[model samples]
Target: MTAPSPTPSIDTLERRFSDFATLGEALDFAATGKRGLNFHDMRGNLARSYPFSEMRSDALEMAYRLIAHGIQPTDRIALVAETGPDFAALFFGCIYAGAWPVPLPLPTSFGGKESYIDQLKVQLQSSDPKILFFPEELSEMAGEAAAQCSVEGIGWTSFADRIALKCELPVQHTDATCYLQYSSGSTRFPHGVAVTHKALLNNLSAHAHGMQLEATDRCVSWLPWYHDMGLVGCFLSVVANQVSTDYMKTEDFARRPLAWLDMISRADGSVISYSPTFGYDICARRISSQTHVSERFQLGHWRLAGNGADMIRPDVMQGFVDAFGEAGFNARAFLPSYGLAEATLAVSIMPPGEGIRVELVEESELTGMPGAPDRPKRYRAIVNCGKAVKDMTIEVRDENGAILPDRAIGKVWCTGPSLMEGYFRDPEATAACMKDGWLDTGDMGYLSDGYIYVVGRAKDMIIINGKNHWPQDIEWAVEQLPGFKSGDIAAFAITNGGEETPAVLVQCRTSDEDERTKLREQIRDKVRSVTGMNCVVELVPPRTLPRTSSGKLSRTKARNLYLSGEIQPYAVAA
Candidate 1:
């Protein structure tokens, strides 16, 4: 057995000089190398490892089996994205079989069975997969969800056994449809973003160039395979560049995040890994709780400590650096980036070695609100997300569709080869985001000397710890209460102690103090049931929430009023 080493002795593979036109070519090139994927358990012990050569061989064989089972080229094959060798082989197998693979999320941190089932059904309906493959452990849930969408569902073991090997693998073109990436926030509703082979390869190439990846570079990731950052940035990018990677499931990392650092410390090569701001916060908090945090981890070789996926918190980044700085961790290793699933992965990445840069601008300037200069001024620290990746162009446009000048925040627009083709079978949704060739990212940000600084989201989406939670979804869950009405609840994000968390303000009618407290607890439980978030539930007087001119509940206005202290809660304890 080959012992696990960060920089194991193996034949060096030649790097691809030219960019691959498709993932197939990329994987074929990677198979020439000795580097591949290494899976690990929560304890940081190696579970299994597969070199690129073995991965490609197994994938090709599985592709033949899938083809023999009448899975036509470009057919939809949905897989429950579990972090294991099965998912690894099946993902590549779909690529080899010329089938468009749709990676669905496993159980999330918050949502329970019903919420997960609802999410699965929505994605299944949107993707319209011909078959859904899941591990045996999740067979009942996956099969039930697949049945709801009228699709065939098979467990991994049965799926492999049932496949025949009488037919040949289908040829995949460079420009063919590669996979469908559904946005994380689309669980309440699903719109499958269609990414082509050319688009994926373009993004992968941009990642390789942006990161300045080298042969000796290794990766450690605990991000879910369903997430774009995990699938493309961590998994596929390494494959394209022939870099070894250590994998821990997202749940595993959630339970024991220090394992990620442990793996990094053991690896005898340069390390590259990325996470959202919350991930850094979680790790820092976990370490703080320990009585005697060891100094065994060596992060001196950690080259790219990336922060992205949601809003980047400078304070959180500082906390992480402070906690690990003594253990050979460098503050300059943090690489703040900005991107979305619609763009395939990265639009902008902080230049290597530049580290985190913050601009402390007046709050009035960012919000376009007039304020007395003589008054105690409030400032917001916006972290620079760096310049656009190779070949990607970014523009900030105002509400009227006119492009804004630099440093003026507006809707972030991007146009690049990595942009998605469109939403699968949903031209209306596609038309809403795509105009001409540019994609409206639905994110608000600004640019200064080519460096991008994201301020907030254009939509009423509350992102807590990198996980997306739609305000409407939270409100709907609360509305299920006996006394609550549809428009009586509002959910939004609030910054507390340098961390962004969800806060729901409810318009209550009753004045009974005990009754109201019970109601507040009920709302919290309901929201938690749906979103898996423990939000600050505040009961406000009726009509406290602002409404748009059309009489619709304006969550933005409500949030603004709450932050400005204009909307006071009644009979509520903070």
Candidate 2:
């Protein structure tokens, strides 16, 4: 039987708003407080409660052990970020040992074993870590990847049993490289973003002030630890801000998403929780009309409902509100944010109580394509991602790097103390994205009245015959067809007989031959309604489309595989 975790109050040590020189100093201060992390099982039962005081002692021991085992300062230690105390202690342990901790993703459900190994091997090759630390259960896969990379692999459980000697920890400055963060979905051509202690601390401080995090505020998260939103926002931010947090493993959340809400509801104070659009979408879809929301959840204390890590969907937000409104879920708690790994996490955050906002922009404007007189004007709802964070200046720039005026769509660029030093060991790739201390966030968005509305990634735009078409517009339209959901369709531009045309790869689940053909036509018609041009729609098997590490549809990979004939489409009868 598991015991309930105690609620940490602010009566003991005063909250310091992350006003520290380094993360080590931040942890040193937080160790004096009662706030800590509480992890729950799949059923939302308390599994383990780890306080900062105990974790500090464990981290110090682990740090000494690393040094005693020949680990040196500035060495990179790859960690498979599992949702447990071992990962928590080892992550900070790497920092205390003056080594850069690289958080890697665990194997997801959709990808097969070899696929998972390939992804891990590539990342390990990029980071070239001195050692790989992972949970004992994943030793087989982690060991294979480590062997392929010629790096030592050690499970933290066994490593903890090793002898530790008390020795002087290396002195760390604010500018020292704290860690290397590979952006979500960076398995191919991965470029690790090296972040400094000052940058991480600055961003953590910005969060405390931006959200106006209250004393009674606690956090609940089901996000994976490798993604920036999960790492910098929920985990590291929780530590640097000295706030108690409840965590449900990402896998557990996938199996039983409602358990996330249960944990949040069980907490006694104001709750600050986050999820992408898909997370909200699943929860809203889980409950039926007959199910009583109040009987299961008491969400009145959830003050800050954060939305990010993917495109924010107003429809999904509305669905969630409609489902849980009767149970005290407020619409105003929605917080849409904009960020990237290169920025170290948050670039802009919507103010509290602002909720989700949108603007209907011409489809041509969003795609950077000139409108044709013969075609009807169409519009897409672009969500407002809110104002830039403190010290982070955002600008819309043209292809020539010239700044654009308000509401003029262009490449999104940001520069601030929160930005990374550079892509580790990849100067050429770093130079391509950074200029004059500003990071060119390949996303295209416009600013209006101090609020930013992100359109889409410029690379994902499909240009054919001098007109640009956004894959999202076509994909969203196709998703409206029955039996389809988000990420079921991938749209991109393909070259056919020396001519460019839009190609759509949709995952068709229907087994009947006639139904599959009809479904393909339905998707084609739906896409044509959005693009105003004929599109080649291929009906592939379900789960055939590729997804990023963050579970986002990867149109680029989909296109590559489709063109290379790796993804086979079913034959439709004439």
> In order, what lDDT does every prediction score?
0.85, 0.86
lDDT of 1 by residue, 460-571 (tens): 8788767777787888888888988888998988877666778999988988888898998898898888888788888999888889999999988888888777898874
Candidate 2 TM-score versus the reference: 0.83
Q: What is candidate 2's lDDT per residue for 1-574, written digit by digit as tens?
A: 6576654835377888888988888889999888898889999888888988888889999999999988999999999999888988899999999999999988865446775787789899999899999999999999999998899999889999998889999998899999999765434557799999999999988888889889899999998888888899999998899999999999899899999999988987899999988788889999999999999999988999998876677878999999999889999999999888889999999999999998999977875656678979988778899899888899999999899999899999999999999999999988988999999988899999999999877677664422345677678778888888988889888756534578988888878998987787787777665455678889999999998999998887787688657899998777
Residue 169's lDDT in candidate 1: 62
TM-score of each: 0.95, 0.83
Candidate that scores best on TM-score: 1
Q: Give the backbone clash total of model 2.
A: 0
